[model samples]
Structure formats: C-alpha cells, structure tokens
Target chain A: MRIFDPHIHMTSRTTDDYEAMHAAGVRAVVEPAFWLGQPRTSPETFYDYFDSLLGWEPYRAAQFGIQHFCTIALNPKEANDPRCLPVLDELPRYLAKDRVVAVGEIGYDSMTKEEDEVLARQLQLAVEHGLPALVHTPHRDKAAGTRRTLDVVRESGIAPELVVLDHLNELTVGMVLDSGCWAGFSVYPKTKMSEDRMVRILREHGLDRVMVNSAADWGSSDPLKTRKTGLAMLADGFTADDVDRVLWRNPVAFYDQSGRLDLDDTDGEPKPDDTSSFEGNSIRRGGE
Target chain B: MPNSGTAPHPSLPLTPEARAWLDTALTEIATAPTTIRTLFPAVRRHCGRAPLPDGRTVDEAVRALLLAALPLRDQALTDEVGALHRYGDPAEQRAVLRALPRLDPEGTGRFLDLVRQTLRGNDNTLIEAALGPYAAAHLPADEYRQAVLKCVFCEIPLARVAGLDDRADAELARMLGDFASERTAAGRPVPEDIAPFLHPFTTSGTTTSGTTIHGTE
Candidate 1:
C-alpha cells in the first residue's frame, strides 16, 4: 500500500530506514518538530534544529526517493521550559519555508497552564500561517488531555478540520473524531497501539477520517508501523483500497489543506537529479 | 612552510590561484546551489586533487570552499556557508572546524562557535578538528584544558591535538599528573598520551606548535 505517515520523526531515524521505508511503499512522510531525547539549553539550538528540519532533512529524504515534510512548533513539553520560549519568536520565519506544510506536534503534555497558553498562541499562528495543526495529546490521562486539546483548538477559531490530534486510542479516538478533526493513531511495537489493536479501531471507526502513523522517534517507536498495519488489516479482511484510504488518502486530504504537501510520485514522475542542491551546497563529494 | 601544529587553516589564506578557482567555484555553487556530495567531486575535477601536508583531503578542500565563501564578506557568500554547513555531512562539518582559523582573509570574525560545536560533539573527526591549531591558539585556557580532558574522557589520542607542544603548561601538567595518580590509585594504568602532558618541559611540543609524540606507554 502507498503510504503517507502523517507523524514520524525521520531525523531520529537512519538513512537505512529511509531506503527501507521507500522499499515498503512509504512514498512520503511528515516529520514534526518535537522534543529531542535530551533537553536543549538554548533557543539558538532550537533554531539550528529547525534549520536542519527545513533544510537538511528534505535533502536526505530525496536521496531515498521519499518526499519529506515537517510541522514546525515548540513541542508541548518544551513549552514548559522558559529557556525554550524564545523559539516562539523564531517560528514565523521558519513557517514561511517552502516544505513546512504545517505548524504542528503542538498540544498539552501535562496540561500545565504554560502549555495551555503556548497551545492557544500556536493554534492562532497555524491560522495566521495558513498551515494545519499537528496536535500531540499527552500520554498520561490521555482521555482528559484529548478533551482539553479539542477545547483549546476550538477556542482558537482555526476550525477543527485544520487540526490533527495524534496518539489517539480507543478511549480518546471517538472524542477527537466527534470534534470533526483528523484522528491520528501512532501504531507502535508496544505502548501506543499495536497493529492488531489498530485493525480493531479501523473496523470500529470505519476509516472515514482516521489516519495511522508510526509516530516513530528516538523512543520505543516503529517506523514501519504503517506498512505493518496495512498488512495486519489485510490479514483481517480489510482490502487494499481501505488501507489506501486510511494510510494514504486521509493524511493527504488533511495535510493538503496547507497546499504545501507535494509527493514526487503523485505525478508518477521520478526525480533523477542528484546534482540538485538545497541552499548553496549539494551532497556531492569529490570522487564518484 | 608554516607548521599546521603552529598555524591553523583559519590563519592560513588559500593561495591566490586557489582563491581564484574557489571564488568562481563558490559562485557557481552559491548561485546554482548544488549538493556538497555532488559539488565535492565536481570541484575536484575542476581543481586538481593534491593533498596538503596538513593533510587537506578531497573532502577537506570541498569544505574549504564553503569557508572561503565566509571570508568574502558578502551576504550571499555568508548564506552559502550557512547552507553548506546546514546541508553538508559530518565530514563537511569537520572541514568547517578545520576552517576555523580567524586570520581574516576578508575581515570576518573567528569561528569560535564552530570550534565549541565540534568540541561538544563526541565524533572523533570533530574532536580532532576542535583540538587543532586554531582551537589551541584562540580557545580560552579553561575550555582548552577541558577539551584535553574531554579527549581523555572520549578516548581520543591526545597526540592528534595540533598545538599540544606550544600550549602545554604547568597547569595541564598538574592535571595530567593528578589524572595519572587517580588512575594508579584505582589500579588502572595511565593512558600513554598522558606522558607528554605530565612532563611538557621535556615533551616535543608546547600549546603553540611543533609537537609530536614519538612513543607512548
């Protein structure tokens, strides 16, 4: 099945993972700005990371024939740290970059008052920037957190359809779906939701506006979960068309709202130019 | 010849012939925007690949093209360096660190941040660059000493540090001596690189230049 993983941290992944992803029919992916495994002490570090996401990552993705996009945001957990708050000022410039399809991975981590304030502002930025929201719901007390996330998104007046509430499960999926936003499930080897459990959710939810992703990162995540979920769904009698709708079409429909989402294979024409460079430098080395 | 152990690449200007070639090449790269991976080999084809004594490898010369862009004092040139660093691979990053000499071929300031960045990373190539001559002469004494300790911590051979001879001081000797005692106290043998730092008076090089470790243990 052709797939668009709406939320996967490809920067944390390896080049080998990219090759394997292309092989597994992952034609495109959206890498969101989130907390690295370690805390950053300075806002300059965040900008440097944002620059890489905007500049380096896209170049890396293209080598493997996969289209890479990113959501720029001050992740929920980092919003709590005062040191990182200056990044909010740096957002607008990055949001203007060509491949930045969405302002995302923004939402409540602990539902702190600080997180609430940041969320409200970023949602407004999403509306201002004309980008979709990739909202990350907290792992702890997820049901209440998802509800709180929905309430805040509603408060911003950005429209529910423009927001994607990720890391949803049985208890919280219905509430997010009820709000008319895209419901994103992060299928994992464990924790979030397994492929079998995801198949069950697709069966219950009917795949109308639901999307699945690996949400893969430096943590205990799986990059191939979308491919795995498709196979699992096939085993459970879900047709290829159904897999296409959930993994490919839904994410495309949601993110394409930004109008910046472009896949190389969308036109079925492969980009053969290796000499192409981003900014001023190319990946070209001295010898063949 | 200026000893690299004394004069870092940043202090050394690219030869006039090299400067002209790099100027045209960088204009093509900066204006056209090519990948370092593609530009790296392509530039070498245009400019013959002769390794420098400081051992400027093919990748080093390609990275130097970006550094060359920085000293031109043009906004477009600065952006090119930023793009190259942003998009360049780790080998390219080490080249940036190697290019950190602040000799001001075009009056741009030193690349202390780049040196600090390389020192912060655990990558040996980066560490080697961070501890090279530019870092030796310009890096603050405390940070310089810390970088040496970091080398010991990361198991990088201290011999690779460029200015070990001219910069090695009594303080560094005490630190290495203390480190040796601690190792002896724990029944662990002191690392071989510690010998020169412990006895800098008799050692081959100072923190400034011309240091080489003949034998270790």
Candidate 2:
C-alpha cells in the first residue's frame, strides 16, 4: 500500500522513523509549520524554521526517499505571541516558493481573539495566493472549535473544498463534511483517534473527502499509524482500491488544490555505497 | 595542470540586460541590508537562469557582487558574510560558497568554517560548492583529501572539485588506491572520474599559495 501521510512532523523525527515509514509504504508527507514545545522569542527564528522546511529538511527527506512539502503559517498556539506576529507579513514570499503547498496548522489553540485575527489573515493569504489552507481545530472543545473554524473559514470567502479541517473526531467530522470541506484524521497510538476508530469512521463516512495521517511529531506517536489504519480497513473487509484511495489518492487530491504538489518518483532506499553527509554529519557509522 | 587560483571577479560575461539588473540590485542592496533578503532570491528571476561563465548561476554572481560592492572589510566583512550564509537556503548558501574565492582572494581562512560546513553536509551541490576555489585554497591538506574522497563516494564528478590536479598529493592517491581496491573486492567497477587524479604527476617546486579555483582549469 503506497501511503502519503498528509501530515507528519519529520523535523522532530529521527532517520529511523523515515526508514520505518518508507518500509510501511509512506512515500510523501506534508510537514505543517506548527509550534515547537519551547516558545520562540522572536520572528527571525520562524524564518530559520521556514527555511529548514524549504531547504535542509527536504534535502534530508530525499536521502531517505520521501518527497517533503510544507505549509507555512504562524501556528495557532504561537499566534498569541506578539513576537511571532511578524511571520504573517513574510508569508507572501514564502508562499511564492515552489515547495510550499498551503497556509497551514492555522486555527484556534485556545480560540483566542488573537488566534481569530491570525487565522483570518492567513486564510486570506491562502485565498490571495490561490493555495489551500490546513485548519487545525482546537484539541480542547473540538466540536465548538471545529464549528468556529468552519465559521471563520466560511467568512474568509475561500472555497470550502480548498480547506481541510484537521485533527477531527466523530463529533466534528459530520459538521466538516456537511460544510463541504475536507476532513483530516490524525490516527495516533494514544490520545487522538486510534486505527480501529479510524476504520470505523471510514466504515461510517465511506471516505469521500477523508485523509488519515499519523500527525507524528516530538510527542509519543507512531509514524506508521496511517499504515496501521490501512490494515484495519482491510481487516474490516474494505477493498485494496478503497485502502489506496484513503491512504494515497485522497491526499493527492486535497493538496493538489495548491497546484504545487509534486509526487515525482522517489528512490526510497538508502544507497549502500553513498557516503554523502549533511552539514558534515553522515547516517553512516563504523563500517556502514 | 598546476594550481592557478581564480582571478578575482574576472570581467563578468553577462548580457547587457543581466548586467544592468545586477548593477541595479547591487546599488539597492548596498543602501539597505534588508534589500538582499528579497533581491538575493530575485536574482534568478530577474537576471535569468542561464549559467554564468564561471559555471555559477546568476544568483551566485549577485553574491559575489554583494560581497565586492559592500564597503565593509576585515571583521565586518566576515560578520556580514557569515550572516548572509547563516540565514540563506541551500541554493543561496551555495551561491555564497561560490562567491567566497573572489571575496577573500587571500587564503586568510576567514571563510574556512563556511566551506567546512558545506563539506560536512551530504548535499552534493553544496559539497561541490564547498570544493570551490575558497575551499581548495583554505581546506587543510588532511581534510581536503577526505572531501575529494567523499566526492568520489557521492558520485559528484571529481572535475567539480577545484585545484585537484595541483592539490592531489601522495596521501590522496593512496586513499583512492585503497578505495578502488575495495570496489574491486566488492566486484564493483571504480569511478572513472578518479583516473586523472590517480595518474602520477610531479608538483612544481613552487608551492601553491593562493586559495581559488578557476572554472576554466
């Protein structure tokens, strides 16, 4: 099963995660610009982070055979920070770049007035840039947050089809799907929806505009949750075609709205003889 | 071929339009440090994507222009150049590396860290940029030899490395010999690019003092 994990934080991940993800058939990923655990003191740091998403991170992923693309935004959690507000101004140039696919991870953390302004502005930027927006519903009060998120997305005047309301559950899924927006599920080992639940959601919703990702990051999460979800669907008697559509094609169709998703042939194995290093560091150890 | 280092900013072989755009950009960047942030990426979009006479992109040429046009020197030059590199993406970083030979013509080691950083990374383009005239002149003998061997390992053409013919020493040759033997033992053919470096040649008695690699060589 060729999988395209629509959301995964590879920056926080090790090379082993990439290897295992590849072994599990994950060929591509979209790393949204989310807040790190430590709060950033300034906007310049976000540029460096954005630059890595555009430059070093993609290069690193290529070494492991995954094509990496990213969404650029002042994440919901950071929107409340005054120092990070300037990132919105620089979004235009970053949005113009080839690899940037969407204005993302943009929505309410606490559903603050500050988050409201940032989300509206970024959603407008997405519309102006003719790109999609990855709207993250607040983990706390998700049903209400998803409702507010849908309201904000509607008011921004962006086509609902171009918006993906992510980190969803049964409570929020109905509203997102009813609103004509894409519904994104982050299948996790704990806390978020599990593989069995995801299989049940698919069983209920029938996978029209659904995308399942591990949303793996620095937290205790499995990058192979998408694959696990696929297995659950198969065990529940879904066809191979059904699994492929949910795992691969759904993401391709959603992000393809950006007109920037490039799924070129990626060489997924580490070449045995290749001794190239990044920033002077190599994946090689004593004798390979 | 002897290690004849690159001539500093040999008259750019640019079309009238490209030269005009570069001149305007240099003026803007000189007046405001902030201008480079936008103009640096705009170089390819404005100056055209065609390869320059030195095999650098038009964007790389602007890097040399910025380094040359700025009035800062010594520690100021070092700090400005370092910041320019620190904030840049790989292509921009590659541009800075390509421009370094001309910016610090004397192998004063001001930019040695930048070159070494590129050499450490696995990006073949950045590695190739690291092997430019600046690195060729500044990289220590031991590290230089390892970088060339790394080029062989990564399949980056040995020809991309500057000053190889002049800098190729007995140690590098021995390392390549062992590498070739290993490939043979593994039933793999050796890389063809190493042939020119492996052949025996006497170095001129005059030591190569300069740090630069002329693309023409």
Candidate 3:
C-alpha cells in the first residue's frame, strides 16, 4: 500500500498534509523547484526556495515518517528574462549535494526562441553532469513543444532515456513515448488531465515505465489527486500491481538511478545533546 | 534560577479572562451555527451540529466548538473555514504533541505563553528547531544553497522564516535585475555558483550527473 509521489511542493503544504500522507502510506516524495505564484527577482530568492526544499521540508516530512527529495532546474517560462541567470549559475553546488535526484521541470512554455535556447543549454548541462533531465511541455500547442523538446534532446546528443517529458495529454503522448522517453501525467483538478482520463490512458498504455503525479503546487490543484487517481484505476479493474507500478515502483526506480533517494526512518523529535561546559562557555546556561 | 541544563517549567494555566474570551467566542459560534459555519464547512461543521461522540455529554460538542474557534483566533485557519487547516483537528494536534513530546514542554504550558511564543511571535521557533538539523542533514546541497540566497535577499533569519512577503517581492525583482547585470559584465552564467538552487521554470540547461529524468504522459 506504499506510495511515492514523484512531484509535489511540500513547502506549500501543511504539517497535517504530512501526517495525512504518511497515514495514507506515502513513504516518500520528490518536490521539484518551481516558480511560486509570483515571480522571484533575485538569485537569493531562488536560493531560499532551494534551501527550504532541502531543509525545512525534509525535516517536516521526517516528523510524519515520509522521505522528501527534490529536482533542481530553471523553469522555461522564466528563461526569457535575462535577469534569471545569477540564480542559474548557483545550481551546480546544489546538484552535487546528496538527495538531488533529477534536474527537471524544465522545458518550453511560450515556445519562444529564448525558451528554446535555455532548454538547449540546460540539456547540455544535464549531459555534462550525466544527470537525467525533466522536461515540462508547454500548455499551448503542446504537440509542438513536445516535438521540439524531443528534437532538442536528440540534437544535444544526450541519451533519450535520460529525459522525462511531463504534463502529457492525449495529443502528445504518442510522440513522447515514441521518442523513447518517460512520460509523466499530472492528475490535476479541472485543468491538465482528470483522474478518469488518467485511468483511460493507463488502461490503453499498459503502465510500462509510465507514471502519474499530483504535481500539486501553489495553485488550484488537489494534493490527493494521486490517491484519487489510484482509486479510479482500481475501479477501472486495474490490478493492485498495475496501480503500484504507476504510483510507486516506477518513481522509485527512476529516482534510485540518481543514487539520491533515501528512506530511513527516525524518531521525529529533536534530542540535542547537552554539554555542561565546552568551548569556553556553558551551553546549558542559555535555557535558564 | 534553574540549572542551565534544566529550565523551570512554567505552571500557569489559561487566565480567567482569556478562557472566558475563548469560551464566549466558541459559544457564540456554536449557537449561531452559521456564524462559524464556514470555519470548517465540511466534516467539522456537521460534527459541530451532531450529538457529542459520547452521545450524551456536551464535552464532544464543546471540543468541536473549541477546535473550530481556536484557529480563527490564531488567524491560522485554511481551506474550509469551520474545519481545522493542515495542522489537524485539536485532538490530532494534541496527539501529535503527545507523540513527539517536545523536550521543552513548558513551551506550550500556558495560553498566554503559547500566544507569545507561537501566535504573536515574529516566527515559529518550535517548528524551526524541530526542522533545522534534520533538514541540514538530508536536504540536497542545491536546495540548501537556494535557501541561503532567499534568506539574504529577504533579510529574514533562517530559523522559522517561511518565505518572502509581497513587500519583498518587488525588491527581489530589482535585485535580480542587478544580479543579471553583474553576471553579464563578468561574462558568466546568470546564477553563476547558485545555479543549482534555481527551479525548473527559472533555470536554463540540464542538471548535473547522477540525477534521473521522468517524462509526462
């Protein structure tokens, strides 16, 4: 009954959500860095977001016995802005850190030349680092973005298997799977893809290396969309194993390849060691 | 003074006025029903109207009443108004505290103490302390770098700060512009050393080695 959500923004969620997810058997999650509803102006702002993903979030998740991981990438929507580069320069240090499983959620939005250039550079970076890349296909003219994304990955000479094309609808699914890449479906509320549609896709596609996510962020999205989708799959007569593969196994297999996924459980509370006297000061006195 | 290793636990309970204020609000909301009806609006609202869990005692109703009212006073309500937000119902909140059992027990010992420490404070120190070390040990290095950058730009202390406020947004935008200018002059990348912290929407180029990529279907 365990689950692994490949995409979720835990920072936007509450502790109750952690507890609920744990109760529902979500053992781990991968939170990709994304644009907050508002734009970030400086590299420092991006820095703080990354810190929370790695810092406060994991700690919070641990309290509920869930493992937290993240993907680091510059989003394509903001790539056209020349101001976003300083933050981009600071990415390598984070990539080297343990627990960064993928470089993703990157791809075109408006299909502008700037987005194309940014995608190319990021693809090259992924190749240089030998990391897998997560591609976010544009909402408008998705077929074009998906095609262009596949072409760019091929043109860059990076292995097709190293790319994850996200937010696929019926129109672009064939091209993505045909391109020999992983296809991700974000089960959203009244927007991207519905749970029923997701189930239909799973039924037709047979769940071979395919995955589904809530992709819940700071928007009108459902955090329990994955669970709902799982329920739909069950109702649609999909076996528990099929449900498990899409919900848990595939994500774990994909992330484990990065060697960053860890799922050790710990006693949730802090138990800092006490010192009577050390370093020329008595640490215990501060509490008094 | 207590020993440095053991601070004296505060023994004060809720003040009569404070308890009375809370009780009064709870009663008003409970009687009117619709007034605080939006608080939890879903399960909690109905629970408030249903007979107590014990079937006869008013305490269950009272507890539900309090659960619905306390969050409003604290200004921490979310989602459905009548229901508790992501923190959980009052009983669940108590259960979480009991299970984890903060070492600094006196932190929430009194109503005024809780208010000063959590509700009225500049930050939630307890949650921050709880998260600090674990996050330091587990979060990937890139994410950590981004957090440091956020702390510097927003001028907030690392401990207990959630994020930049709207007021800081404009300043962050201007600072980013300046940062881009500096990078262009240096003929370097935009994020330079901080590239790993950028989100998928913000950065250009692929990730470093050892990461996996998944496509959307």
What are the runs in model 1 whose C-alpha is more than 4 Å off? A266-274, A277-288, B1-217
All candidates in order of DockQ, best leading: 2, 1, 3
> For residues B1-217, what per-residue lDDT tens digits would candidate 3 score against the true structure?
1112221212213345434544554555545543443232222222322333333222233333344333232223322221321123222222222222121223322222221222211112232322232223222434433444443332224333232221112223444556667767989555433332232223333333322211111
Output the TM-score of candidate 2: 0.73
Show model 3 residue runs off by greater than 4 Å: A265-288, B1-217
Q: Candidate 1 on A7-29: residue-level lDDT in tens?
A: 99988998778778888888888
Report the lDDT tens digits of candidate 1 across residue range B101-203. Answer: 6323332434556678667654445567667767766676667777887776555677788776666776778778888898799897677877877875545
Per-residue lDDT of A1-288 in model 2, one digit per residue for the tens?
999999999999988888888888888899999999889989899998998898777777766667889998999999998988888887876786657889998999999999999999999999998999999889999999889999999999999999999999988899999999999999888887999988888889888999999999999999999999999999999999999999999999999988778567655464321224432334422112
Best by DockQ: 2
- Candidate 2, superposed: residue stretches over 4 Å from native: A266-281, A284-288, B1-88, B91-122, B133-159, B168-206, B209-217
Candidate 2: pairs in clash: A277-B121, A277-B122, A278-B121, A278-B122, A279-B121, A280-B120, A280-B121, B133-B213
What DockQ values do the models have?
0.02, 0.16, 0.01
What docking grade applies to model 2?
Answer: incorrect
Q: How accurate locally is residue B62 in candidate 3, as Cα lDDT from 0 to 100? A: 36
Which candidate gets the maximum lDDT versus the true structure? 2
TM-scores for all candidates?
0.58, 0.73, 0.54
Q: Each model's C-alpha lDDT? A: 0.73, 0.80, 0.58
